[model samples]
Target: MISPHKTLLSRFYLIGVVATIVGILVVAILNLATPLEFIIAQLQTLRQGGEFLWIHVVAYRFAILCLLATFACVPFLVILRRVLTPISQCLSLKNRQQSLPPPLELKAKQRLINLPFIMAPLNILFWIFIPLCIFGGTFAIDKIDLAAAITFFIRSTMVGFVSSAIIFFGVESHARKVLIPLFFPKGELSLVERTAKLSILKRLRAFYRIGSLIPLAIIVLTLFVLYLQVNAETVSGKTYGQGVLNFSIVVFILSFLGSGILNRQISRSIADPINGMLDTMEEIKRGNYQTRVNVVSNDEVGVLGDATNRMIQSLAEKELLRDAFGRYVTPEIRDEIISGRIPLDGEFKDVTVLFADLKDFTPMTEANDPKQMVQILNDYFKEMSAAIKSKSGLILQFLGDEIYAVFGAPVSCKDHPSNAFFAALDMEKRLKDLNKRFVQQGRLPLSHGIGIHTGQVLAANIGSPDRLSYLLLGDAVNLASRLQTLTREMDARIIVSAETKQYLPESQTRNVLVRHPQPVQIKGQQTKVNIYLIK
Candidate 1:
C-alpha cells in the first residue's frame, strides 16, 4: 500500500523536478541570448598577447559545459526518484514485519547493494565522463593549444575527482547509517549489541568527518597557493589570476551549497518519522492510548508508526476487557481466560472438594446480636478462606456460615490431594488459635467441621445470567456435604471419604485413624459410601 509518507515524498520529488526544469530553462535562455560572439571576442584579445592565451577559451567552454551538465543531471535525478520510490515501498512493508531491529551490518550491506544499482552508473557518467566532455568541447570550440588545454583539464580533473569522491562517500555513508536505519525496519536491539554498533558507527563517522575536513582544507590551500603563484608572475594591470580565483571560489561555494541542501533534505526525511515514533511511544508508555503518530511520508518509519498505533489501540481494548472481567471474576481466573489456558466452557475433572460449616451457626445467630453474629462469622470465614488460598485451593462459594471449596479444578495441581489435606490441617490449627483468643476474652470459642471427598465432578459456572458462580456439582459435592454432617458422629474436626484417603500420599494418610469403613446413605446417592476420620 502507498503510505502517506511515500505519497508526501512523491509530491516533494515532483515539486523538485518542476523547480529544476524551470532553473534549466532559465539558464538555457540566458546562454542563447548572450550569444557565443561575446565569448569568441574575449578569447581573440587574450590570444594576441605573447602568452599562449588558451585560458579564456577554456574558462568560457567550462561555463557552457557546466550549464548543460546541470540540465542533464536534473533529469537523471528525476529518474533516480522513479527507481528509488518502489524500493522504498518494499522496505516499508519489510520493516513492519521485522520484530528484531535491523542490525547496522545488515543496513550497511543494503546501502552497498542499492548504491551500485541506483547511483554508481549515473555518478560515473556525471562526475567523470562529463568533465572530460567539457574539456574536449572547449578544445574543439576555441581551437586553442590542445596541449595546454589537456594539461589544465588533467589538473582540474584530479582536484574534481578527489573532492567528489570525498563528498559522495562521506554523505552517502552518513545517510546509510543514520538516515536509512531510522526509516527502515528497526527491531529491538540487545543492550550490548546496540551499544557496540553505535560505538563503531560513531567512531567511523568521526573519522570520515575528519577525513572530509582534511581534503576540504587542502583544496582551499591549493587554491590560495595557485592565486599567490599566478599573482607573483602576472603584471599589476592584468586580472587573469583574479578571474581564476573568482571562478574557483564560485564553484566551491555552489558545490558546498548544493551538498548542504541535499543533506538537509535527507536529514529531514529521516528525522521526521523517527521523532514522531518516539513521541508516540512516550505517550503510550504514559498510558495515553489516544495518541497516534502522524503519517508524514510513505517510507518505512511512516509504516511503523501506523502499525504501532494499531497495536496500542488493540492493547487499550484488552485493558478495558480485563478491567471489566476482573470486577466479576478473580484475577487468577481472568488471567487464565486471557491467556487461553482455561476454556470458557468448563471441564469435568477429578477434584477434592471441601465443605465446611459452623456446627451451631443457627443457635449462635439466635443467641447473639445480628452485628456480633456477622463479626464472628467474618472472623471465622476469613481465617478458613486464607488457609484454603494458601494451599492453592479455590473458595468456590460462601453461603451464610457455610463455605464450599475445591482443589484441582480451575487449574490442576499434581499433588492436589496433599494440598487439600494440608488445607484441612491448617484450618484445624487456625481454629485452635481462634479458641485460645476466645478463651482469653472469656467467651466460648467458635467451632467448624470440614469434609473432603475426591471424585470426578462437573466444575463450571452455575447461576443466573446476571449472577454467576464457579462451582462444582455431582455426587462428589454431595458426598462432601454428607461427610460434614458425619463430623458430629465421628467426633473428629476433619473428615474424608475412603476415596479421598486413597488419593493422599501414604505419608499424609498415615496420620489419619480410619474409623472402620462404614457404608453411609448420602442424601443424593442410592448406594452407601465409605468415609474416614482424621485424628
Candidate 2:
C-alpha cells in the first residue's frame, strides 16, 4: 500500500511542476506580445528630471532577464523530476520497510550528505546575494549606475546559486533512496543492529527538519522587511513598487512559514507513534508479554500498535493453555497439540499397559503400623512414578499401592512394548533399592509384581462432570490387571501377556525367561487368553 506521506509528496510535486510550467508560459507570452514602445514611454515618465535614464534602461533589462530566467526554469524542473523520481521510489520503499534510523541519527546522516551540498549553499544565496540584488536594484533606479550594476550582478548570482541548490537538493534527496542499498547494503541484521540503524535514521530526519526552519525563517524575515521598506515609500504616493513589494513579501512569508510548519507537524505526527511502536517492540523482544501500547490517535501507527498488542496477548494466552494442558497430558502430547500435529480427540491405538501391585498388600498393612504402611506406600509410589516417567510412559492412575501406566496412548512410539517392559524392569530395580533402605532401617522388605499386556484400547478422559481421569479401558486393561493377579499363581515377580511378549523386540524379549504360556479365562471374556510368566 502507498503511504500517506508518499501520496502527499506525489501530489505536491505534480502541483508544483504544473504551476511552475503554467507561470513560465504566461510570463513568456506576456514578454513576446507586450510593446517595448509602451514600456519605454512609461519608463521615460518615471525617469523625468532624474540625473540619468540608466535606471529605466536597467529596469527594462531586468524584466527581460526575468522573462528568460522563468523560461529556463521549466526545463530545469523537468531535469529535476527525471533525477528525483527514482530517488523518491527508493525513499518510499525505505519508509515502507520502516527501517529508518532515529531522528538524531537521521539528522547526522543528512548533515554528512545533504548539508554541505544543498543547505549551506542555499543559505549563502538567500543571506548574501538576494538581499544585495534587491538593494542594488533600488540604488540603480536612483541613478548610481556602478552600485546598481554590482547589485544586479549579485542578485543574478544569488538566483543562479539558489536555483542550482534547489535542483541539487531535490535530486540528492531522491538519489539517497537509490544509493541507500549500495551504501548501507541490505542484509539480515540482528535485532540490535536493525534497531540502532533505525534510531540513527530517525534522529537524522529530525535534525534535518529542524535545521531547515532556520533558513526558512530568515527568508521570511527578509521578505517582510523588504515589503515594509517598499511600502513606506508608497505611503508618500511616489510609486506602486511599494504595494507590489508588500503583497509579494506577505505571500512569500506566509507560504514559506506555512509549508515549514505543515512539514514539521506531519513529521512529528509520523515520528511520535513510530517511537511508541519501537518501545513496545523492544519490550516484546525482551520477553515482556505484559507490555501494551496505547492507541491514542486514529492513524496507521495506532492501528499497528493495537494489532501488535493483540498478537502478544494471544501468544501469552496460548502459552498459559499449553502449561495447563501439560499437567493432564504428557509434554510430548502437549507439544504435538500446540504444534497442530495431533488432533485433540483421542484415537484407538495399540499400546502396552502395565499394572504394578504390592503383593499381599492387605496382609502387609495388617502386619505393620498403619501410619508406617502409608509412609512406605507413598515412597514406593514416588519411585514407581519416576521409573515410568523416565521411560516416556504416562502413569494413568494410582489406586492405593497399585499403579496403572500406559505407553503409546496420547503419543505413540514404535518401541512402546519395549519401553513398557524396561519401565517395569526399572520399577523392580527401584523396589530392590527401596528394600535395601528398608532393611537398613530394620523394616520389612518390599515386594511387588508388574503385568504387561499389549492391545488396542479406547484411551481418553473418563469420569463424571466434576472429576476426570485420563485412562485406558478395554480388554487390554483388564488382561493387564488379571496378569498381575496371576503373578501369585505363577510364582513369578512379573508376567507378560502373549500379545506383549510377541510385540516386544526379540533382543529385549529374549531376556524374559517365560515359565509358561497359560490360557486363562479373564472375568469378562468368553475365550481364554494366553499369559506368559517371566522368570
Candidate 3:
C-alpha cells in the first residue's frame, strides 16, 4: 500500500490540476454559450456580408479563436508539469522501498510549494490577454450593436478573472495539504522552522480570504448588469428579478458544497496524526513502553511522535539497566545510586564489615582438580552472597576464598551491625547444608571463618579513573581481616570485635551463643583488642 503521506500528496496535486482545468473550461463554455455567438452574428450583419457567407465565416472565426486560446496554454502546462513531475513520479512508484533521496525530496517539496506563485501569474496573464485580444479586436469592427459587444467583453473578462482565482486558490491549498507533509519526513522535523515564513496554515487562510471575493464580485457584476438593462428598459422587471433569484441560489449551493469539501480536507490533514499520538500516550500511561506511534507525516505531529518514542525507549533501557546493575549492589543501594541519591565521592558512616575465608582453602586446592576447586569456590560464594544479600548487606569484594561485605555505609540502617552478625550466622548455617551434600558425594566437608567489625569507615569508589571499585577504607577494614586470621587461632567458626559486639542490640545478642570476651593483641595493632568468639 502507498504510504499515507504519499497518498495524500498525490490526491492534492490531482485535485489541484483537475480544479484548475475544469474551472477554465467551465468559464469558457459559459462565455461562449451566453454572449459570444450572438455578438458575432450582430457583427456579421452590420458588415452586410451575405447570409451564406456570414454563417460560414462567423463559425470559422469562433473555432479559430477558441483553438488559439486553448493552444496558447500549452507552455504553461509544460511549466506546471516540470515543477510537479518529481512529486508525481515519486508517489506513483509501486514500491515504497524506492523512497526519494533526501536532497531530491527537499527539492520536490520546494518546487511544489513554489508552483502556485510561478503558474498563477502566467495563467492569469494568459486569461487576461486571450479575452482582451479576441473581444477587443472584434469590438473594433464598425457598425456592430455597441451594447451587445460591450456585454460580451464585460462577461468574458469576469469569467477570466474568476477562473484564474479558482486555479490559484486550488493549487495553493494542495501544496499545503499534500506536498509539504509528504516531502518533509520525521528526520526533518526541525526543518519545519525553515518554513515558518511560508506557513501552510497561514497561506491556506489567505487563499480562503481571497477566494471569498469571487462570489461577491459575481454578485456585484450581476446586479450592475441588471441595473443597466433596467435603465435602458430593454428587459422586463419580472425577468430581471427572476434572474437575480436564480443566480443567488446557484452561488449559494456551489459555495456551501465547496466550503464543506475544503473543511474536511483541512481538518483531516491535521486531526489524524493528533489522534494517533493521543492513543499512543494512553498506551504509555498504562506502562506499555514498547508502543510507538505510526508516523504518518513529516509535520509537527510526526516530530512529537519521534520525541515520545525516544522518551519511552530511554525509560525501557533504564529499567533493563537497573535490573542488571542491581546484581552488583543491594537493590536499595542500586536504587540510591541510579536515582542520584548516593554520594559517589565518599562518606564516613558506622558500618559492620564482615570478612569470611575458607579455613583450609590451600589444602583443598592442592588435593582437588582445578575445575572441582573452581566449582567449589563458586558454590561457596553463591551460598554466602545470598545470605549476605538477604540481610541487606552489600558485597564489597571477593578475594579468592574470602568474602568482604559492608552494611550501613552506601545505604544507612539503624541496625546494620546486628544485621551483619545475623548474616554471618546465616552463612554458617548455609555452609553446613552445603558440606552435607559434599560429603554425600565423597568430597571433603568445607569449613570457613567469619570476622565482623563495626566502626566508622570511609566507603567510596577508589582507584584509577579507568578502573575503580567501591571499597571500605580505614582501620575498620584491617580490623575485620585481622579478626578473620584470629578465628583459626581462637579455634572458633565466627568471631566478633568488641566494637561490633557493643553495637548489637540486646535482643539479637540474646539469641547468639557467645564465648567469654578475650583481650588479644592483633598483628600490626599497638593496642590490644577485646573480641568474643561465637559458639
Candidate 4:
C-alpha cells in the first residue's frame, strides 16, 4: 500500500496544477483574443511607452504577472503542507500502523475540508487584482474616467465568480476523493461544522447561478459597455465594436465548456451510488442476502444506503434460520410459524406425540468405531424421518440415537392419530432396510421401539422471545416417552396408549393389555396402564 505521505503530496500537486491551468486559460483566452488595438488602448491608458511596441510590452507584463502568481503560491503552499505533515509522519511510522489516533484524524479531516474554502478566496482575489491593475491603474493616472473603470470592474467581478467556482470544485474533489479517506477513513466529513458543507443542493444552486446565469449576465454587461463606448477609439482610431464582441464570445464559449465538465462530474457522483444500490438490490431479490451497499457520504443518498445495509443484515439472519430449520420441520409448518399464522402463546389441540429410541444402541456405540456409529445413526434417522414426514409429521429433534416428533398442531390433519400409528409402522419397515445394508457393510444391525399417544396438547411456539420452538406440552408427551421406556420390558417394537389406539383408522389388533408402568418388583408406586402392542 502507498503510505499516506505520498498520497497527500500527490493530491496537493494535482489540485494546484489543474486549478492554476484552468484559471489562467479562462482569463488569458478572453483577454488576449481582442480583435485589434485593445492591448494598445490599455497601454495608452497606463501611459506606457508602447504605442508601436504594445505586443512586446503586453507579453513581458503578462510573463512577470505569472512569475508573481507563482511567488504568491510559495508561502500559501508552505502553510497548507505544514497542516498535512503530522498525519503523514504518524501514518508512515513503520510496522504498527493500521490505525490512526482519533484526535489526529479529526484534526486532519478539518484541514482538508478547509482547503477548497481557503484556496478559493485567494484565487478570487487574484482575479479581482488583474482588473484593478489595468482599469484602476489607468483611472489613478487620470487616463480613463471613473465611469469606464467602474463598468469594467463590475464585469470582471462576475467573471471572477465563475472562475473561482471551477477552482473551488477542483480542490474539493481532491480533498473528498483522496486526502480525507487517507486521513479520516470513516465518519461523516460533511458534518464537521468547521466549514460550509458543499452539498448537492448547494452544488446545483452554484451551477445554476454561476455557470448559466453569470455567463448570460456577462454577455449583457458586455453589450451595455459597448453601447456606452460606441464611439470610443484606440491610438490607430479603430472602433471598440468588434473588440467587445470578441470578448463576449470568448466568455460564452469558456462558460459553456466549464458547465459541461462540472455537470458530468457531479452527475457521476450521484449516478454511480444509485446504480450500485440497484445492482445490490437485484442480488438480494435472487436470494443473495449477504450483499450490502457501500456508503461514501452523509447526504440523502448515503442515508438511503445505510438503511439498505441494515435491512439486508436482518434478512440475512432470517434466511440462515430458514435454511437450518428446513431440515427438521416441514416447509408448510415453518412458513406458518414465520408468517405469524400460528400463535406463539399456547393453544389446546388434539395431536399425537411420538418418541422412538434405539434399543441396545448404547452397547453398540461402545463396540463400534465412533465415526462408523455416527454414520449408522445418521442413516437410521434419515430413513425413519422420511417415513414420518411422508405422513405430514414434523420431526422436532434427533436426540442422540432417538427421534422425537409430533403431528397435527401447527398444521392440523384429520387423521393425525392414524398418521402417527402408520408412521410408526413405516419407521419399522425403513429400519429393517437400513439394518440389512448395515450388516452387508460389516456394521452392526439396528433396532428401535416407538411409543405414540394422542391427547389435547397445549401446542405453540415456546421459549424466550428471541428463540422459540413449536412444541407439544402436556401429560400426553410424557406418557408417550414413558411408553417407549416400557417397550424394553414388554419386548415390543411398537407400543401405543389406549387414547391413541382408539383414533387409529381401520384398527384391527385385539392386543390390548393392562400393565403397570413401573417394575412389578417396585410394588408401591405401580399404576395399571392400558396399552396395545403393534406387531
Judged by TM-score, which candidate is best?
Answer: 4
User: Which of 2 and 3 is ahead in TM-score?
Assistant: 3
The residue pairs found clashing in candidate 3 are: none
How do the residues 1-535 of candidate 3 rate in per-residue lDDT, one tens digit apiece? 7665555555544544555455455444434333223433555474787777767976886686557645655665666667677777666552455867776666565565556556666676776666566666766775334554555456455544544545555665565455555554333444433332223465367447534655566556646644654532554566556656765776565545545555555455567667878998898889787877655444566567678767778988987898887876778888887888878789998889999999988987998899998988888898998899888999888898899899887888988988999999899999999999889988888988899998998888999999988888889999999999888987888999888888777786766747455688988888999887875
TM for candidate 1 is 0.46
Candidate numbers sorted by lDDT from highest down: 4, 3, 1, 2
TM-scores of all predicted structures: 0.46, 0.47, 0.63, 0.72
Worst 10 residues of 1 by lDDT: 189-198
Candidate 2 local lDDT, 24-56, one digit each (tens): 333233222222223334545767847556676
Give, for candidate 3, the lowest lDDT window spanning 10 residues: 31-40
lDDT for model 4, please.
0.71
Q: Candidate 4 — which residues are off by over 4 angstroms?
A: 1-9, 32-65, 68-76, 94-99, 112-122, 125-157, 172-196, 232-245, 346-352, 360-392, 397-402, 408-446, 453-457, 463-469, 473-486, 495-534
Q: After superposition, how far is residue 412 of candidate 2 from its true place, in Å?
A: 2.5
lDDT of 4 by residue, 420-448 (tens): 98888889889888889988988778878
Off by over 4 Å in 1: 1-335, 366-375, 438-444, 462-468, 489-491
**Could you tell me how far off, in angstroms, the CA of residue 454 lies in candidate 4 after the best superposition?**
5.5
Model 1's number of clashes is 9
Clashing pairs in 1: 4-297, 5-297, 5-298, 6-297, 6-298, 100-187, 101-186, 101-187, 101-188
**Cα miss at 9, model 2 (Å)?**
39
Instruction: Give me the runs in candidate 3 sitting further than 4 Å from their true place.
Output: 1-253, 362-379, 433-446, 461-469, 503-508, 524-526
